[model samples]
Target chain A: MARRNQHSKEELRAMAIEALADLVEREGVDNFSVRQIAGKLGYTPGMLYHLFVNLDDLILHLNAQTLDALNARIDQAAGHGDPMAVLKAMAFEYLRLAREHTALWQLVFSHRMANQAPVPDWYVDRTRHMFEQVEVQLKDWVPAADQRQRQVMARTLWGSVHGICLLHVENKLNVAGDVAPEAMLESLLDHYLSSCAREGEK
Target chain B: MARRNQHSKEELRAMAIEALADLVEREGVDNFSVRQIAGKLGYTPGMLYHLFVNLDDLILHLNAQTLDALNARIDQAAGHGDPMAVLKAMAFEYLRLAREHTALWQLVFSHRMANQAPVPDWYVDRTRHMFEQVEVQLKDWVPAADQRQRQVMARTLWGSVHGICLLHVENKLNVAGDVAPEAMLESLLDHYLSSCAREGEK
Candidate 1:
């Protein structure tokens, strides 16, 4: 077993989160356990509990890290560009993130705590922040849209994009053909946004 | 314990499936097991294998049953009416089904076999039939639209509706308030279909 005393609290936390993520990636959330993660990190279960309130807290922290990484990717994809182009870029980046991190993405959407525990505010904030990035670009595209309209539009579009990604990631969209998810996202964005275009905007 | 020898083979199969569904409902798919199912039905593991090719096959059959139930609800909702009215009705019924059968709905969208087994064709056919219901209505609403447009439109709208339902089901959409999922569905349908309305039609 590795010595926990050799690492600082911050270092131990980071290592535990990475080990948890790796476990989720290999065995999926369904098969995940705190003991397995503690074992993997060469720490006692007591050491893990000392670091985290519980397994759910640890999972939430891992999810928060995922949201942070996704937020960064979206920020990168939104590098100064025409509003619509940046929007497209962001959606593409979101798809890539979901594809590259299928298990984590699935956990974000599908995993619920043991007893319907409320998701922490910080976790919710991270989710809202990701959409706020989309809403920011949306304002540039449709300056006249109101706050509620922007909110709904942001949720609608993100949810739609998420569904597309979910279908692709879960292997529901195309199995035998090896179709690129980017092509599918391109068509969906074209169809959806064209429909959003005002009468003369097209 | 259920008596395995007392029931006919068909009765045993039905009992096993019912027990499986109950297990999924109580514990979620993450905790599902064929042994639990066999135990519930007082059947040997060997007997379950005889009834099903494996657990995956049994789960597929359960998913198939869910699709059938959903299809029936959609058909009932589609009772001859104005095309838009029927579409709205269908969407509401879908939300109801998902809310009422959250575990089954999650399994339908999220679960996959461990070995990447090909989804049986009949399963694919059931899914297509659900979309075909929407396609049939779209034909009535947009007769001028061609086949490819109908296919894309069907998938896009369904994905959007699903995204909306997913957010609500997963408790991400309206955590702090009692915002009705029906209200969200209505706004999405209005925005999506109004955008679909042809110039003359609108």
Candidate 2:
């Protein structure tokens, strides 16, 4: 009897999904094909059909994976440090991912993340958990900020950091020099923080 | 016999571009066809061909109009107010435009704007002129702020505003109901300006 492959169902599923990510970047999402994916990996289209009904199903899976990767990065970075320092670090980490994974970031982010098919409940838990960490860290920084202001401030920072990252990925900023973006972001954050310090002195 | 249309050339061009914008929303930039534009209005594709060489020419024309519209909105909102107020108003106007015209905003924004064929020098003039107006206005607010701090401050404000606008358009904010975005933005502006005033005091 021929030796049987050792991979279990779950292992095979993981492998297929990993392959899908590489395929998305190589071939833009709009043109991706289930047949093409299976063909490149020496699996028949019939096997892919068994796993995913169509490109939408594959897209939903990829979207969830991207969010999980983002949540993991933030979680890992937040592990040890002053919460304020870690919050700033998380901003850098988030921007770095957006820069490196522009195509994938654009794909999932261009469509609202929550609008996609629901991922496992843990996914929402992870996202909300990360935001809560950010919120608490921010309160430590701006103790006088009211609950509403705190929420809005957090949202503003979220937008500001993401904006710079979006510009970096899209080459939107018109600056002449090749300045390190993260360094520029650090400077911006420092100045913003200083303004707050000066405010509290009054 | 060809009958003369009542609308002036400028009016016709403007109307046609409005129709073009509608087509773009229905079909994204890549899928858009000049033939479809003419067909929708019962005109032959030849009419569109006569106005522009290809899709690039047409898109460039449409995008230039968008930049012009931006300048008009900024002029209407900010004029030569307090430097900080000018930036604040522009931020508000930018958000308004982005929220109102989601697809068109993405098109006219930095990345897509740069990729299109080089517009006339005046077109560049309009964009730069607006930035220059802000740079000049920013002077009064940052009288005490160092040059580098001022640069970073302006950049941060602009980036944050852009980022927030995009997040809103993407429906990622989950802003509370019954609160106009303007109200929230205006309140945030007050908070930011008050903080800046404290910075100026020191």
Candidate 3:
């Protein structure tokens, strides 16, 4: 009880989320429980409830953290270069993180809320930020594209990249051939971007 | 027991898979059990064991059935036409099936076999056959592409399409904007095929 008082509610919330991430990374998101996180933090489930409405709320917070980490990685990879080169770098970086943190990445996309609850606005903003990274680069690479076109192109390209990675992570890419996900991503970008460039010329 | 003896093993296997599909459709793949399936078939779990080695084997059969249904749908959609049109029609047919049969489609991709057992050769062939649909059209669309280029191109294109659909079905496409999956698929193919044609010209 004394230990609990030593930390503010915000600090306890952060601690619980960190513990949740570690637990999920080790055990995966399936059938995960708040009790396990509370155990890790040396708090009772009741105490943890003070920080989160429920397990869903806690998982959402953890997913938000994963999104933050992904954004940071993309930002780091967005070095000065040709827009095409930067986009590819960021994509490969995204793939690397997904591969390295498979559990966390899967949770971000796979953790459906109870009863199909609407994702909070902040969480949607995080996802939008990911697409915006691609949008910014597309703007540079295909300056003529209107906002609608840019939005579709960014989603199409990244969605494809994501599909490849999702299949790769899930061991479902075997049907695609022996070609690595990296090669497929490169080929996809090469052809799609070239097409965009040609369209721009026309 | 008398009822079980009346049906051949093959008949029983088919019945079990049908029941499994329905159960999964109604409930979902999560925490699915062999007992529910046996109950559906008026057989005991031990009897189900006679038909399938275990739950994993049963689910694989269900997935195989799903793939066969998908291939059939693609065949129905692959009416003779310009290769581009055929591909687009086939892709849309796929998107339609995915949306309508969301649960079955999800089970096919989401079910990971226990112990990481290798997916059987027959299963791999079914997946290959799915890609072959795209390859046939690509050959007509890009006559210059060799077997390897065709393979890469087919996978890259379909993988992107699959990624887009996966996101849409999972309700994760909200970040992409309000563009329907159908429209996005059309835009992706238009850009990618145009790019390939230009490359062939070069």
Model 3 residue runs over 4 Å out of place are A1-9, A27-39, A42-50, B1-5, B28-35, B43-47
Q: What DockQ does each listed candidate score?
A: 0.35, 0.33, 0.59
Q: Give the alpha carbon lDDT tens digit for every residue of A1-202 in model 3.
A: 5565678999989999998889878886564577888888787888877788888898899999999999998987776898889889988988997899998998888777765578899999998887898989999889888999888888888888898888778776577556687888888888788888778777
lDDT of 1 by residue, B96-130 (tens): 98898888888887776767688899898787777
lDDT of model 2, residue A120:
47
Model 1 chain B worst lDDT run, 10 consecutive residues: B174-183
Sort the candidates on lDDT, descending order: 3, 1, 2
TM-score (chain B only), all candidates: 0.90, 0.70, 0.94
Better of 2 and 3 by TM-score: 3
TM-score of 2: 0.77
Q: Against the unseen true structure, what C-alpha lDDT does each candidate score?
A: 0.77, 0.64, 0.84
For candidate 3, write residues B1-202 as lDDT tens digits.
3673688899989999999888878876564677888888887788888788888898888899899999998887777999889989889988988988898998887776765588998898888887888998989898988988888888888888889998888888776456688878888898888888778777
User: i-RMS values of the candidates, in order?
Assistant: 3.5, 3.9, 1.8
> What is the C-alpha lDDT profile of model 1 across A123-145, one tens digit per residue?
88888787788888878776777
Q: For each candidate, what TM-score against the reference?
A: 0.83, 0.77, 0.88
CAPRI quality level assigned to candidate 2 from its DockQ score: acceptable
- lDDT of candidate 2 over A1-202, digit per residue (tens): 2224476666656767777778868764444577777766567777765676655566666777887788788878878777557877888888877877876776666543323454445444544555555667777777777767666666666666777777667654554233356765775566555555455457
Clash pairs (backbone) in predicted model 1: none
Worst 10 residues of 2 chain B by lDDT: B175-184
